[model samples]
Target: MGEMRAAVLFLWIQCTSGWMHPKCQIYDSGEDLGHFLKWTCNYLPRHAEHYTAACEDVTAIEEDLLGLPPNINTFCISMANGQNRSMSLGFFSQFQDLEYLYIDGCFTQILPTGNIHLPNLQHMYLIVKWGMGSGCCNCHIGPHTFRNLVNLCDLTIQGYRLTAMAPDVFHGMTQLQRFIISEPCVEDLSEILCRIMNIKSLIELKIKAPEIQTLNQSNCSILNTKESMKPVFNNLASADFSFGEIPHIEEGALAWLQNLTGLSGAFSQEVLLRLPLSGIQQIQYFSCSGSNEIDIERICNVVFLLSIKKIHLANANMRSLSMSSVELCTGLEYMYLGGLGSIHPSPHLKWNFITSLKNLNRLNIDFLRDKNPEICSFQKQPITWLTKLTLLINIQILFAKQFSCLVTLQYLDLTQNLISNIEDFAFMGLTNLESLDITQNKITQINANTFFGLHSLTWLDLRNNPLIHNIEAMSFTHLTSLKQVFLGQVNNPLTEPVIKLNLTLIFGGILSQLTHLYISSAMRPKGYMGQRVQAG
Candidate 1:
């Protein structure tokens, strides 16, 4: 082999390390990415067939026949960032292995201006936006022209301005399994998405029109989506039904969302009501985001939630959910319940709500203080402190001691509370306590041996307070595992000799084991003496 050819082959070996050979250490081009690409394809044309061109914004991948390897697998041209005078499109068509294509940004001359027929192509992503008229104005993938990619499996397009998607736009991808179309509101996604069922093998369909706003073009007053709903998919597992603001949603008529494990969109009571819960036995994720009145009760009735592992009911008017059984959803994992501005987080209103989530590893209960007047009321103790700290909340009274379930509790937050002093044995039951935070509170003095038996305690917070003074030497002696202690506000006693901080108890003894300590500016070690009190 020639020296240059050998060098290229070696570069290819480096480029496909994990994919080609586990032991081979290929070359590292460092800052020169173009050099790496040139050397790689030059030496290993056979191996180059595996380089998926799924993210090439042609404008950014300016190549004039120099980068095309005959056997390339994927060629995704996502050009959403800048102008597209063919960032490099003038010469990238030669890569025969292109499969998944994801293009974004403006299009000038950098677009596939002709019928793109790459046999190995499985996924095609074409995102066209306002990038029209410069040089991109004349480029085209005309009706039924690019349908020759029969082996395509997945396709995604975002922000393309072509008004119509011919009936056979995706007619040739026989092996297609997943297809997605994301575009601006100016063009209808239904134009491209409605024909997916033709690919028989299509199992996953995603229509993410995040910034696209749909306007009833035909009548301007009413919505006519029937043209895109007739074809039913038997294998679709996930779908994305999102757009800007939904002007109108047809109730009791979502015929297309019957057998899905995941669903997201501007849905109303009807969509959540008739959802085929019986067929979706493995639903782990659910989102009802957007300004919609979701019938929390009707939705809870979808017994399939019993199979749900994680649920996101964000941005909806969902009041209360009564999930009262460990057997109800044994596989339940995580729950994010903070969309209802009026929904308050309280176990008392309905503690039976999540008791059944046996496998629940994480739970976030967020209540809008602006919506729930009750949250604004300053009570003597933290409102929702569950005794069974088996759950995690960062408030006052609802601490571990309040519940038997807290045995598994690892993190405890006591910020901005009425906790004045570290009560003796306050942490006695917290056998698993790893970190403790008492920040933004009124902690005057840490009582003697305050952390009596918390041998596993590592982090402590005593910041943002007023009366903190005199750290008793024996206070944290039992905390052998204590690594970093936050006492930045500890009354500096080094200044006043008459009222010196009993450093003999702190530094001279066991407390010396502390590696990190924070002290305040007011009290000195020599003259530290003052009326320290934890203000409520």
Candidate 2:
């Protein structure tokens, strides 16, 4: 009993000593300290030696931030109601151990003074929300304001109404690797891009200045120019620019980056029309999004360096794909094309490009309306390599032998296709298919042979249909590996009010592997609206 009392006394002494520091005070009672500024500081979890501080709703900026922990490593300040104070200062140097800093609020100026410096800081985020305090500009950051941050590696500055920024604002950041900027009012982006030319250690760079109307050779010439004895950027691997519908991009403007591999952004037709002739190469993954109708035949005449492995086009109208368009990119493994408003139909080409690819694994084409009858036969060639496929076209019928060539397919989705009938042997050769989704269609019945050859199917979804009013016996006997099924009805006022299917008859087959079943909008004789069953 004496030893236990001694141990308890020792722990109490340690706790008291730790909290006795001037910076580690506790203020959980919300008592006013008689000061206009309100802030708090505490030790971070698992980092008993470090502290984080935050101040919110600040209305003023003084020369020094007093009454807070002086050695904090992380600091965040939000001045949503700032009074647009401008004073030349070096106030942030007090946090000698500061590593991360975040500043957010609406103001006319942020860090406009050049005296601020934090040599130990590695990351900084500055967000200036849209405001009309001055009604002239949201925020105006000065040049060379952060030249003293020698150890800064990652920096992000996002403001839509930034009007003034010096060309040499990013001068002393030698170790900078990732830089992101989303200033839309800066029309002359070349000035900013020129400042980062000397950052040889940069790996990822992204800019979204939509107001820049043109991207020409002169705007990007400094990137290829030599500073000391060699090119400025030697380690840049990824660069994406979203310069909102620029009408022109001079050839060779972006071809200088020899080590770049991944590129993504939105470009105009004038740029994509000249991409093949732009001389840019070495890109392996490319993703583009736009609303313009792009002539894909011209861009796919010759493979871009023949090193492309994935091409994702989101909302870009890529019209009429031919075998030669995709066959040239021999290393492609995944292709995703989707657009909701694209109306140009592809001339139903025999999708030989799919079977010709030995490395292709996934293909998704969504919302590209094709009213052609031949578009239903996706696998005209013998396709035994693709593992996943998705088609959301307006196909009305699943004819016999339609998917017979997809013997190795594992996952298939044909949702919202208006399919009304599935002939016998429609899925005969899909022996390895594991998951199937046919939701939001017009399928009215489930024949015995509708899923005859999907012996390995595990999950089936048939929700939001007109109504499954008929079911031939043994409709699910062939799905030996089935585990989950979704059967939901989409109410139609024109259809007669009646309970179409009996649950016992649908589950009469040998469904020993079934574990979960979902049924919605089901009008049962017992008045149960929806039912969900879980089995062993």
Candidate 3:
């Protein structure tokens, strides 16, 4: 009887010491005795469906994964040390219903070659860290690596030093749509495109290669010639080629890609002129920066053919920008002419060219330089003739009753300028202005009629300024439709303490409609008698 009693005590200790069967559906190898016992006692009785395991050695938890419920659809494994690890073939073959599998920070040189059938898996991301050694140069892909994943739509293979891939590496992925290769060590662009052109359903392709210099005809002849045996990229809609230097694309290089709507890269004028203009008439979005010389005449000659709608020129020499030259491309709706600290347009000629763009919806002209502001000057000029435009930036100051013709202006950004004072009725005709950003300026105070006619304004950003002391009671009275206001960091704290604002007198009746308000902690007033403000 004494021996029997000792056996019962041993069984009691085993049950209380946090040792449960693997079939309990929640296995945490990293948990200590106390925490494991608490979880088993509190959470295990409800029959938790999900299972999670954290192991110092990932290989030891491979058997425990098979004991999970068969209906488990999501599985994630994170390795503690990712120096040299290998995933076993057919390791995940049991969980056929799994839909998502994410393996992060696992160092694998090559994927195992075997039929690891996952018929229902839809998404998979394998992010491995290639070790710093000579063994990384031997990394490659074997055939039939992902042969069983028939339903997989998105596949991303990143952080690998792949030297070569077999011809049939992606042979079975017929339904794949999007493939992204970012920051890879691959050199040849034509070799990669030749392998993936068989994917007929691909719509978007983006390659961010920082090491590549040129993409001339020799490397891109696959797209130029028509092959009856191989398929072309007929369904490709958008392509972004962001190499370091200006890639020299030869004539008829991208002529067969009829559905390509957007193309972004830096190219020279001579190379751009060599392209088949009649073949790329459907391309509406083009963003090209000059690498050799900023020839405005060459830019006009190229833009006149494709009928571009939106163009962004960076580091461009706009000295030849004239009314007759800009009128060639009459279909432009949005234009961003930046890095123009040296090209100053005459006020009369600039106004004529701007008014001629009848369909223009947005225009951004930046002239902020390192020197003391002598490039573009419009300190006290009469602003007129922009009835259809909706957005403007960094043109000049907005005097009272000067912008009465710009009735359609809704969004305006005049940040980082040399405007110190805004006279009364400065924004007199901007009745439909919804959002305005005037931060990083030298404006000191606000008067009663500063924003007199902005009735439809909802969002206002007035931070990072010297408006610390004076703000009249009716300064924002006309902005009854204001919903959000950002007034944080309005004073230079290095020179003075935070300024206290009278919320009752500043917002008045408009405070009831404000849904979001941002203010500094030190600027909160004491003994304030107003409604409780909502913080956004």
TM for candidate 1 is: 0.55
Kindly report the root-mean-square deviation of model 3 from the true structure over all alpha carbons.
Answer: 9.0
Those runs of model 1 whose alpha carbons end farther than 4 Å from true positions after fitting are 1-93, 96-102, 108-140, 144-154, 161-163, 183-192, 210-229, 240-257, 266-283, 290-296, 303-309, 315-333, 339-352, 356-359, 368-404, 409-536
Q: Rank the candidates by TM-score, best first.
A: 3, 2, 1
Per residue, candidate 1 scores C-alpha lDDT tens digits across 307-379 of: 5556665653434444442244445566555554544333333445445555566555544222111221223
Clashing pairs in 2: none
lDDT values, one for every candidate: 0.48, 0.62, 0.56
| Deviation of model 1 at 442, angstroms | 10
* Backbone collisions counted per model: 58, 0, 0
Quote the positional error of residue 452 for candidate 1 in Å.
7.9
TM-score for all predictions? 0.55, 0.69, 0.72
Question: What's model 3's TM-score?
Answer: 0.72
Give the candidate number with the greatest lDDT: 2
Best by TM-score: 3
Question: Whole-model lDDT, candidate 1?
Answer: 0.48
Candidate 3 structure quality by residue, lDDT tens digits, 221-311 = 4434343333367777676545555455545455556434555566666666754442555556666665444455666566667777777
